[model samples]
Target: MTIPRSSCLLLAGALAFSACNTGTEQQSSTAAADSLHHIVHRYYDDKMQLFPIDATFNGEHQYDGLLHIDISEGFRQRLDSFAGRYLQQLQGVDTSGLSSNDRISYEMLLRELNMTRESLQFHDHLMPIHQFWGLTLTLPQLGSGTSAQPFKTKEDYEKFMQRMKTFAEWADTAIANMRKGMATGYVLPEALVVKVIPQLRDLASNDTGNVFFGPLKTLPAGTDTAFASAYRHTITAYVFPAYAKLQRFLQEEYLPKARSSSGIAGVPDGKAYYNYLIRYWTTTNKTPDEIFDTGQKEVARIRGEMEQIKNSTGFKGDLAAFFQFVRSDPQFRIFKTPAQVLDSFRAIEHKIMPGVKQMYALLPKTSFEVRQTEAFRAASASAEYMQGSADGSRPGVFYVPILDAKKFSYVGMESLFLHEAIPGHHFQISLQQENDSLPRFRRFSWIGAYGEGYALYCEGLGRELGLYTNPYMYFGRLSDEIHRAIRLVVDVGMHAKGWSREQALQYMLENEPLSEDEAVAEIERYMAVPAQALSYKTGELKILELRRRYEQLQGGQFSLKDFHDELLKDGCVPLSVLEEKMKRRFE
Candidate 1:
């Protein structure tokens, strides 16, 4: 989930409707349309300035020299003020005559603005970064000169150095915010804080071998030999010292004072914050109790299927025993080298290609490759897809954290690929980014429920793609589904139901074939970002519901390929908007 980019490239636009208007209609609509268009463009330009790192990641080079520090009170006020003004201006746009797509864009913009405004009520900035993800975690990757931040030119290197200096400032601000959070009873869990200390310690060291020196090792075939020494000195003088300062703050100032409690519910107004996050991530009105019950039902249903698979394998013991067998079985861990692991994924891709070609009518022209996760963060990383640059200069990458090839299991490779690689994030993101027909905002925009949900839904498509033929692979698919199902329970359980970290970890160890380390890492991830794990299931279930309804209503007339194409045609949108669109098109 520590993927390079974050949420959608978004705003409103009316250009999508231009082609359908008659001369008189065009003349009447043009002025209003032009005003709406100008407003959207201006909003995007402003956002690019406010969150320059995000802009850099979104393929806007102009902001690469800067970094936005939202941890500051001033920055928060600026963001909230911007959101309010944009919301008002956008509401003034007349949507009655806009095209359906443009109307959807308008609705999407309103949803985002409203969400942004509502979120400003909380003290989320109090806890700016965590071990799992955020600016702190991503800075190393960007500093390595391998991610979205370009390091091809001297100016690029200079911009990155400036960004590093800003990062040091941001780190200081984060410490200040953490202090504020402590005073306001908004501190992170002790377990999460413990994890954070080590990461900071790792980052702050005067280790020239750090990721910040990655560019110096192998210059990007440019005439930058002289600058490497200066950059190295900067890392030592500025980056390392800044990190050391942050590490000292974490170890000496913050950790002892961090709360021993596990859930955010223990904090001030924590219950309200959790509920708000539920809506924020899922984009739904459902209560946490509703999602909890849904999770219980899904866990039970998936367990039954897993049981059936266990019996089919003629395994003698109960589900727990089978889980242990899968966890410990040497047969599953046949991968000899990292290359073999990558090759295994390639094989799965090849095996499913024909079916993939037939299943979806539209495909991304953006190329994809499978690689190992970067060394710096691989220990805590998950298998995830990094979206390519929209301009097609970089290929989307599926990074698998193969810490030890000898222990790598192929059991989950098929399902993992289906979720993170071809036909999952790569497919969904690339097509969205590649589709020039969509407004620039929508093209890069992603709603977790819509985007991640679609990827989770893709996990089920393995059966149709001639995968999961091996009983172990089938179990892997079940295991993956149960993983998401478990998330729904534990994410809601911890933050809302007072479930302890130990209880959540035990629940996962009992249900899934995860090592204790893996289970612990996952539980902490949910703790760090509450209600996020719920999005995978919440979004996937909606997509699956739409698919089922379309299949039943259209019956023999339903075109699966066309259905898929349409589902992804508009890129990522809120589930509600997608449902409305589907009903209008099919019903």
Candidate 2:
């Protein structure tokens, strides 16, 4: 992300010209820097206009009433033009004269612009809705009263209603796009299509059970009855019908045409698409073959560790048998209620705070919380973190989806807390949002390799953070790591190496301690979002490599806290940019 300065001025004539040249250069640099600043701010403003949902999530309420039909051709063209325009403007900026941070911003924006332009060649809009993401799932969360969408005032309510109406129109566009995908070969796998049907059906339901109606429960006291009536009417009239139409379309039309193959390779140019995804998610040039080989080595190495743990516990069987024991044993499934599961995570937070303070000098000003994932999406949702507002009005939340507390194992709780809460996402994200020094886009930017990788790396900090004393908890930490390694194997295996869904599932079950349901969900998540699974392990390895390199180079002077702070200080960036930035700063 850094731009190297121009080399030394050479000859007598050049030296004679240096004085006037220096003044001219100074003026040019100032102008270029000013232009770059304008482009950066202008791009963010335009981006917020196009992606209003993101704006709302980032605490920009001005865009709350807008919802773009992102799947539509018109929207896609507008997005392409937006990227192209900003990219052209950026090319005019002189990077050689910019500050280090401005150079980073320039490079980040350039990468984003090129990636967006390149990605437009793919037909991503054709298959708009997926079980894991897309507006179908996202809109419900926004309307649920607990998410980013505000409902504190009448204006908030009206804004959401506008969004709801637009969403109905958006559904029709999605249906049309999906039909176009069906005609082409870009349809979802049948397994994923089935999962989406039920989610839509739940949203489409007319009863009070519909999540879109959730806002009504928390209306301010003495609110006008007509406003409440209008809210319910909007859900029933616009939202329900939209979900119903999408459900019917998916069930009757899309499902019948859905591909049976689990991998994106079944679609036209799918391999190329997956290659783009690998570059996009990992932010690296490593090929699928390289990643697959890394996964194999990691899996073998972690399995050996698991075996040692199994034998230490005097388990009467091999690693596979011990995995079963962990999954089924009553000791692991100790939580009887959702509250107990949440409490366990909170307790882990308390246990790790002293270590968290010691391990890092920097911390977020924003508060953090542990909450249950909503019931409507809990079945398919993974445990996740939602960043708090930049203004710190709302606390960042670590959502644990507890479908059955009896089946919820305590083994991974410590690692999970470290990954999703305190030092993982909440710290990385909140600090970025709070740092007024960064440009708006860089503060909110998401480079999956850096973000997810940092979180996965946090999982390895269990021992350093005063937990993982128990063999099972340590095993859980290893299980999580191996799970990510398994992703490196199976994600590339399925998407790139022509492995079947069954083959991937079997590989997961044999390698990790995931339950049948958990295994299926994980595998399908990889299937739905190609190459995304690679981010965690790919990112974690790079970070760990950087830490080791710095430790060895600095020797006695190496400080883990200082290293952690420096690494996270810029928030998330491409792995290459991160390496360059760290090398320049530390080495």
Candidate 3:
């Protein structure tokens, strides 16, 4: 995992261009940066050709009406060709005369192209669809809500229905892909398949109040009665059956052959795939055993922090008993409605925005908002962050599933807010989008280790942003941290170690204050997607480690703003690229 710095290492003794100068030097730097910008735009546009949805999020709307993504042989070949050429183009850029920020951007661009190529090597196409993070979920997410699906015009509604027609075809491809995956031993577990069945039923529902009926409900309100009736018939006659056909195909063909194992390691080359994914997400070469052990150590340390809080509150009880108290406590449940659940997050923004100056000198131009998770999916939805439209019209959003908002507590409120809002995804991703100087590929992007790792670090700033004062709130921080730490153990444990779903649930419930229901959902999510949960804490710890190392090396010269600006100025990258960028600065 230690990439040899043979050619253009971007490592220590890599090159020391960090020198001061006068007017002409500044002008040359500016011109060099301008040239990089033009090339970066080309890189971004080329990437959009490969990932259109990402382009839509990046603010390019030419692909706006498109919903279906082609994953066949020709498309893959074209994507691979584009990525290789992009990497070549990036290498061709002259970073030897660039500033530190430009240099970081250059390395990040190379890392991203390489990661794209590496991801292409996996049979991700074989498992192109899943019940969870696959196309099925993504489609509903886009069509059901404020994503790209416009409801203001009659044409928009028709566009979406047109899009749904394509889904039946996609579903067939999905089933075929899963069948191929079964042949290759890349199937989902039977248990996970069972969980997915109910979801298919939800999608195939005939209910008029369904989220899928959103376009129907608000269909201009001005259409002629004939057209209105016709629209209803089209939905019932055409759209419904498309969903039903897919529903039946999955039940009859795909789900039955699904694997009996839970972890990614259970699939073909699962062990090696997960190891590569670990390196990809953590941006380091740490093995599952190393990550699992690190998680355990963090869990124990965080538990001690929680215990100290417990003692301060005069709660003389065991950790499990305390977890029970928090789960059942009336004091924590202040939310009376879904709006209240939403208000909890917005309130945190207002209260904490004043204190942001304490730790941050740079703030994202893209705004953040809190919304309820879309209705039909809310039951299955975990709290999530949706990045803004690349054009800046739509702000970054934190959607909390407030199915029964009255049930939510303020215990983990601050941690959730910090992780989802300012300094988390909103700040990290939006800043990258607004930064035009970095290659288009680097500015608006995702790398699990860097993105989630950076968010995890955002969670760490809860104390500094002035929210850890209340003892229970402080415990919430520890609770959130513990949940991530446990993901390390339970995620790998469930899949790689053949641990049962119940075993995973028990570990979480015993160690964290999450309700049993929440624990059940999380364990199933881990079951559905192996090694994904490890990204948060594993990535975060590495970022913190890098920062500490940078501070030590810079001594009195370290500027926190420059560190953040330099790190995030480029879009997300593999941890290795990130480390190399920092190594250049620190060394």
Candidate 4:
């Protein structure tokens, strides 16, 4: 569920032209290449200014203290003008004379510019502060001094204060936007609104234990008591009050006006907006019905695998009964402490080490770690990987939400580790960042179909990783796949086909071995962010298809390590683009 932060702007790196195979003169080709490079570099620079937070997360700290609140009409007009200017400039270049890699870059940038412009047509800013991806959720993580925002120097502390003030202003803008949305029937789902209120209340608690005081608690080897005292006073006097203002607004002004319906289809222009989201998430032309049907087929296939595992365990019951048994079995919930749960994941890492070496020829030099999710947000957060600092100051982290050790199920741990830790996000993201050849944008870019799809594909490597030997553990892997497949069906169904929140929740309960709370959380996630859940299965199927085609064609010449190496070398791209790249190289 975690991805590297990406800019909404076209943040592509400049690419050079390779030797031309076209019948153009070398001088003309060279001129075209130079012009395109200048255009791309300029676009990259402008995007960094436009999305300072994304730049800061990607290790560029030039705009450290600045925060951009883009909900205003003036900001929207400027952004639209910016996107239009870039698109016009990009189209002016003669792409026919460019190299293959340069062509890919040009196409990718063009797609991004067009998509960004199209997205502005929808009023996403109105319902912006969702439980999953809103500023309300992310600001605390940054302020905690544990995230990408650094706190190593006195100036770093000052920058944080300025950013906090900017955040307060952003909060005011958010309130205004929500009011605007209310007038236009663009409010958030009431269920999600209720989830967000607690988060705001926690941040706005105005206590010493609040995460804003985190940096002051562990000063970076400094002897600056006076400065530290000032920082604390600032947080209490200014920052905490901002959160309190937001909390009051949410509880008193926003919640009652929130939408009663669960789907985006309830809002004005919501149907078209959802269609845009589908295209944005999947990076494809496939319709909602197509994705829903694909989910159905994948669910059936995984169910058959789960049934086989059930019979192997000698369970004398139907699939639903077996699912219930796995869901509540005390034997599977043996962990007594959070440490034990984390240790089990470490054991999974050790068990899979050998197979990982065999599969991936080029491993990331960046260090990796498995950690417990922060206690404040753990309840609602899914187990996810956070990208490390490119300089290796921060290790790539896999954070598991061990809400209650006794409630933790061992069924999905092995596959979960494979997907979120080694050979999945860690490998894909670290390798991308470490490669200096990639443009800064590509190094940190995310195409969910490529990124999440690759992670889901990693789950199938359980047998290769030497885990999933136990029948129940194997079922756990199948269960994880079914979880994604169910998302495909229910995400589109709820948004586009009139399926209610309860219908989606019931579908999950009938098919997967999830607790009612877990089911509710997953359903609400889909409601908050539409079409994103489809990426896992869609991307995985495409990659698997390509792997099969290459394996059959290459026969004895094929190498798994080489396939993985090439697959990840280019970082993330649209599935159609990835398939074409793989075909030209492998086929």
* Candidate 4 clash pair list: none
What TM-score against the true fold does each predicted structure earn? 0.94, 0.96, 0.86, 0.94
Q: Write the residue-wise lDDT of candidate 2 on 1-587 in tens digits.
A: 54344433345557879888999999998998899999999999999999999999999999999999888899989999999999889878888898878888998999999999899999988889888987998999999999999999888999999999999999999999988899998899999999999999988998877788888999977789998999899888999999999999999999999998989999998999999999999999999999999999999999999999999999998788999999888988788999999998989888889988998998899999999999999999999999999999888999999988888999998898889887899999999999889999988889999999999999999899889999999999999999999999999999999998899999999999998889999999999999999999999999999999999999999999999988998888999999999998888
- Local lDDT at 215 for model 2: 89
Off by over 4 Å in 3: 1-40, 87-102, 151-161, 216-239, 549-563, 580-587
**Highest TM-score model number:** 2
Models ranked on TM-score: 2, 4, 1, 3
Highest lDDT scorer: 2
Candidate 4: 10-residue stretch with minimal lDDT: 8-17
Clashes (N, CA, C under 3 Å) per candidate: 4, 0, 6, 0
Q: Model 4, range 515-554, lDDT digits (tens) per residue? A: 8999998999999998889888899999999999999999
Query: Could you tell which candidate, 2 or 3, scores higher by lDDT?
Result: 2
Candidate 3 vs candidate 4, TM-score winner: 4
Q: After superposition, which runs of candidate 4 have C-alpha atoms over 4 Å from their true positions?
A: 1-24, 221-223
Which ten contiguous residues of candidate 1 have the minimum total lDDT? Answer: 5-14
For residues 421-485, what per-residue lDDT tens digits would candidate 3 score against the true structure?
Answer: 77788888888778776566666667787888889898888877788889899898889899999
Model 3 residue-pair collision total = 6
Residue 363 lDDT in candidate 3: 82
